[model samples]
Target chain A: MTRRSGTAVLVAWLTLVWVGLWGSVTAANVLGGLAVALVLVRVLRPSPAGAPAVVSPPALLRFVLRFLVDLVVSSLQVARLAVGRRVELRSGIVSVQVPGASDTLLTVLADAITLTPGTLTVEVDASTATLYVHALDVGEGPEGVQRLRASLREQARAVVRAMGTAEARSHPTPLGRTGDRRREGQP
Target chain B: MRDVLSAVLMLTGVALALVAALGLVRFPDVFSRMHAATKPSTLGLLLITVGAAVRMREGGDAVALLLVAAFQFVTGPVAAHMIGRAAYRSGAGAQAGLVVDELADVSAPPA
Candidate 1:
């Protein structure tokens, strides 16, 4: 594994440990969370070989800030959905094609998608660099799919840049094709 | 106060578990079923563990509770992801609903 990936794994493990022991020692949790956050900030160090060759720190900051805002907003939306009637919630799967060759980029994309409230990553085909997301609410026809793809593409691009792998940009894979419906027992 | 908290946590945990089971049975798709089972179930287990820790009449039980809670939290997401991936791989998902799936690019290998 590359040094960056190794760093990622270590950071992830530490995050897990902190959460696991959070309530046990109050001071430890706070210090551990901060310490882990700092390590992540440092370890996500960018490499020039990353696709696009331009890793923008400001872009990453913007993406993270936006993600946090979206998280809060989506949480409220989910709560409203839970208390109110079903409304127009259309839960369905959508696929996305990412442009990076590295596993780190793909994993980051999946985790980012899952972190959002309205969407959850159902499956990811790393071999093909494709992602499948289950959305809680979708608009009419292809609009929802288009929006999902747009959001994923934007986020994936930002994450790849943050990870410092700008050279891995490949072709934009078609989101999901319409009329590719699968019925059970149609193997 | 400790007794009251323990009782509340136990009741909440049990109630959440029952709801998760009901959701698992009632959901239309396997992905939804897994979601029902994993998320709420993990939360339920966490609550139960915390309650046990709080009500720990002995040190052994506290250690066991912490261990079990840690185990469940770590494995729950992995298990859910595996089940969802399996379901999607099996071509059992509903199409033409919303969102695009790119898995169509990789042809399904013959079983």
Candidate 2:
């Protein structure tokens, strides 16, 4: 969406919230909401870096459905682990490489990862766009790290597909997935 | 039937929150404890909000309840990320279970 439209949406959402809070949407309430929302939007504008959040409805549906499934499955896993006895935990921190990902995509990806039980995003290196995620269980050693990282990178790709601009979508995200394809010369 | 369903959902949400606390106590380190605390708790909150909305049955109340849930969903991860980053930086959660520390090479320390 363009900057102007995004601001309009923000204002509209804020106005809705105000009306909802007021319960009965009177003229006074709506006017008050509009004034407050306009002021808030003007005061706290988001950075230009995430200017284009041109979301695809289908891709977003795909991401949201997959995310909900992950949330349910992972929450259950954690719940079971809590109730059940466990011997040794093979938890580890794996750094996922998602270079040039926009801030909005990163935020969405990190939020999804954290909401999922198996993985939590510890740190996001914005310069390189790397996400350092801590997994609840990733088997063991280097291979485990690689596997989790790859999966999380897949999530990042999904976010891109859902929310990325046309240029951002054309990034090397799908062209040559890391380590999977080795027939041609690997980067 | 609606009330019964609402009760079930609310009870399940409460149970999940308990599970979150259990994991927080039992988990080995900071990161793991956070994993336990965050995921289930967020889901539990969602469940509780939905249950309440269903039972309330008023448009205004339902909207408010859902808005609370939405706010929680947006803010929860941000809080966890800050804590996680801080713990990792301070070397707080680097215990024996950590098999891979790939971040050590990249983020040295914020100067």
Candidate 3:
């Protein structure tokens, strides 16, 4: 994006946030917001912006709906296991690559995934764009790793659709899937 | 009916918080405890704010409540990631009941 547009977008976002925080959209609020936003943007001179995400409202809504469902389901699962008498779990950290994720997309994906129970990020390998996820429970065996890895990639795809660059949105396949048993047509 | 719905949501949220506390005490390790701390607690906060918002039925205040939820959603995961990463690199998970660890073979990401 051009310098002018980037500055405009940043100022607009900051102003919107300022208004939203104040819980009013009066003329005073808008003017104050604009003043603060302009000052912050011009004075602070935030880090240069990266590849702009092509946001799709419908896809964002869908991703949020799915994440909420995941939140509830995973929370309940953890709650049940927590309440059980003798806790037995097969926790493990698996390194999985997210296909087509840039720094921004990867951060969003990690945040969304970590917000849900059952899985959290142990570490991040930004060079390879990999996430080391520590799962609370991974069921029985290696298939568990497969399942979790696939789930992570699936969420990345959803994130890409919601707010990612066009190239990332197109390249949704995890490159390591070439030999995996997961079929192309499987649900 | 609105009151009833709000009560139910609030109660459920509190119950989830209780579950989180219970998990924190019962879970075996730091990572597991963090799992307990992160998810249910955030969900609990969400449900409570949503219930309160529903109860209020005001347009402006609901926006503020939504903002609280948004900030929590954004920051909670980041805090958990930092702690989890630290715990892992410190070898805190060497005996944390791992069935497999792929990261063991590969070096952790550059600090």
* CA RMSD per model (angstroms): 9.0, 3.3, 4.6
**How big an interface RMSD has model 1?**
5.5
The residue-level lDDT of candidate 2 at A186 comes to 26
The interface root-mean-square deviations, each candidate in sequence, come to 5.5, 1.1, 1.3
* Model 3, position A117: C-alpha lDDT score: 58
Ranking by TM-score: 2, 3, 1
Off by over 4 Å in 3: A1-10, A172-175, A178-187, B57-59, B108-111
Q: Give the candidate order by descending lDDT.
A: 2, 3, 1
Q: Write the per-residue lDDT of candidate 3 for residues B52-101, one digit (tens) a residue.
A: 87877667787788778778888999999999888878777666868877
lDDT of 1 by residue, A1-187 (tens): 3556555656666665565545354667757876876676587754422333334678678777876565445444443443444354466676666545466566656655654556667777676566777776656677766776577666766665565354453333322232122321122
lDDT of 2 by residue, A1-187 (tens): 7778778888999999899888767899999999999998778875556547778889999999999898888889999988898757887777675555678778888999998759999998777566788888888666776677678877877888888765567776542355222223323
Candidate 1's displacement at residue B13, Å, is: 2.8
As a TM-score, model 1 comes out at 0.54
| Per-model lDDT | 0.60, 0.81, 0.79
Could you estimate the TM-score for every candidate? Answer: 0.54, 0.91, 0.86
Lowest-sum lDDT 10-residue window in model 1 chain A: A178-187
How does model 2 score on DockQ?
0.79
TM-score of 2: 0.91
| Model 2 superposed RMSD (Cα) | 3.3
Second chain alone, TM-score for each candidate: 0.82, 0.91, 0.86
Q: Can you write out model 1's per-residue Cα lDDT over B7-59, one digit (the tens) per residue? A: 89888777667766766665555555555565556667777888888898865
